[model samples]
Target: MSTVLIVFLLYLIGMVVAGIVTARLASKSLDDFILGGKKMLTPVIALSEKGTDMSAWLLIGLPGQAFKMGIGAIWAGIGVWVGSLFNWLVIATPLRRLTGKYNALTIPDYFESRFGDSSHLLRITASILIVFFFTLYVSAQVVGAGKILAATFDINQVVGMVIGLSIILFYTMMGGFIAETWTDFFQGLIMVTALILMCIVGVISIGGLGNVFSRISAVDPKAALLSAGESGTALYLGLILGGLAIGFGYAGQPHILMRYMALRSEKEVKKAMIIAMTWTTFAVAGAIFLGFLAIPFLRGEIADPEHITLAFAAKILPGWLVGLVLAAATAAMMSTVDSQLLVTTSAITEDIYRKLINPDATQKLLVRLARIFTVVVAIIAFFLGLRAERLVYWLVLYAWGGLAASFGPPLILSLLWKGTTKYGVFAGMVVGAITIVVWYNVPILKNFLYELIPGFFLSLIATWLVSLFTAAEQRRTK
Candidate 1:
């Protein structure tokens, strides 16, 4: 077998081993399976959160956009960095405290408890949106895995996707959250190390920063400009706004925020934030530079820009080293898919099934059902990935916009602002999710700016406006 294939297979096996080892522990209960029993150490919390946050989109989609758009793509990187920082500074400690205080297991559960919503409307609504957008989000990761597998093995994309899905399903189902977190910790390291190495090697290969800039200008001068030097005011503003808007999702991403709740304690948030941001800085910077690096090498030769990182790596690295680096890239995808898989599983088994349907379900039964839904959800995403011809970057953004808009506003307001009502939370979730769908589908609207910006704002507005009336009603009634 080729060294790359061998290395890839070994990485896959290691992930499965991590899952198998953790499975016995995670299988103890629903909380253990989904939240690692809230016993996660600082490093696991930090790395796993970053790993889950970056995904294939970081290595493939972001770099590809950067490659195609040049320096203008830096907005996306900045957005992600700031967004993660926002999560750390603003979202992490409070979410961990609030979730722990209420003993809430999932995002939906938190909503129900926080608002004292006896109607179950808030939980059910939030759960539906989580499952829907998460399924879309998972498919994007599956597509990333398939793309990497196809690039590495020279096989059909569908065949590659199946292989990727099978491995993801096994490890995710077996080890549950603990397995995914431990594996994410390692995968996070691989992603950062490999990307930084690629950046260093790439700059050296191109004769340093000066030569890199000269070469970038030689290829696409506009790409090196912010807004790509668009003359039109609206177009220029849109690029800047849209790029910055990417960060808006950070506050709301269930997969990443879920990590905060899983941390050992609120005390760990600061240390974990430091470690996580360090990884984010190095990895995201490397990815951004790699995009520019590819501009000078594989510009016209590449068919799918999303495959730029893989193609560029194959160009510079030797055979065996290529195997190791590609494994890291694949790690990017797995880290994300596993998180989403578990989160989606949590929504179904804990939020929808156990809470609403079977209030008397046992921990063992819930754990078993979560595993089953893990496979079911992954299979559904696998099929979606097969038919997904869209770029991973945009597909991911669409889903990200939905989740951020739906949950980010409500969660933030509810945690920080005591006035946030359940009716307002429900309104925000609906408006935010629906706006993404409507805005994304309308070509003119999507082309104007990213849906996240408008959706996020509208959701916030909806939450605020609705909360006023509801909060007043509660006061009067009391």
Candidate 2:
């Protein structure tokens, strides 16, 4: 291998070692292993949570979209940003309070307690969706890592996938939540550094932001402006709503909300929120800028928008610097993969195996089972990702939509609306899930309608309508 490739491999090895060490320290207790024992401070929780959440899609896919569509893609970030801000401000504090009050360890656990614990099936089904969809989503990240490795070192894509998976799986399986969070903290910092550097280098290489803008205008004037104004009201609203609606997915995601439940206290939530939002804003904004910055430098040679960062860096920077920049993107991908593996394992070990199949299983036994399940899920996801066609952005968006539409309405109502019934929650989940699947598949709907707009609203309406029509005793008996 070349010197640059060798250096990149060494850095990755160090990260893997760090992850294993963390897992060894934190895996003694189930809570500590999966949720960090609810003792995480503000910065660790914030950076780790948001960093894991955004992943490679932010660094690769979003920028690629921006490079292709110009300023129109900024709305994607805007929509997600607005939604996340609302989640931090309106949802995180209450979620932490209630999860703690009920001693809930997962989103499904929160649902079960908040809705009076009448039916465990709700939790089980939700857990199934999380594991099922999240595995597919995690696989996409795996695919991204493979692409990164392949592009970085001229390695085979499959070989890269195997290498990336082995490294990520080592830390994720061994360390659990502790492993994921600490690694995520480090990876998040790397991501920020790389993006900032990419932005700076890209701008300078292209003669600054003004020259960058001027070139884009010279290429496509409409694409250079904010709003793009290309698609018109329906499409714009759909994209914005689709983007912002991503925030709702957090309430349903076991991995992300695991951060909230693990936080030291409610007071920490406030501090974490500020930190998370700031990181998200800068990281995403910088990535979007990097995409635009690549336009002038790359001309038309940056054929695959997704490869803009890698191509641009390789062309402008030295080999060592290029390796570092690629490492940052790898950090983003691994940070997300670790979190997904932990949560996916949690669904099986905590929710399925321990709760349903073997309630009497010892923690030691459950830990073993969790590790087994982690490998099993990762293997399945790796295959699915290889067979899949879409890039990181599309796969991530689909998974995000599914989780949000399925759990968002039920979660919000169970917390705020006293009359939310089990029937209502179930109805919402079923309808929401069906709508998303069907809408996406149907050509007419996919062509004309945003799947989330219909699925989300209809799910909310179904949840309410079902609650109204159900027997009075069916409601949250508070």
Compute each candidate's TM-score over C-alphas.
Answer: 0.95, 0.94
Off by over 4 Å in 1: 387-397, 475-478
lDDT of all predictions, in order shown? 0.87, 0.79
Model 1 TM-score relative to the real fold: 0.95
Q: Model 1 lDDT vs. the true structure? A: 0.87
lDDT of 1 by residue, 90-120 (tens): 9999999999999999999999988777788
The 10-residue segment of model 2 with minimum total lDDT is: 389-398
Local distance difference test, candidate 2? 0.79
- Candidate 2, pairs of clashing residues: 23-175, 38-262
Best by lDDT: 1
Give candidate 2 misplaced runs (Cα > 4 Å): 1-3, 229-248, 386-397, 475-478
On TM-score, the leading prediction is 1
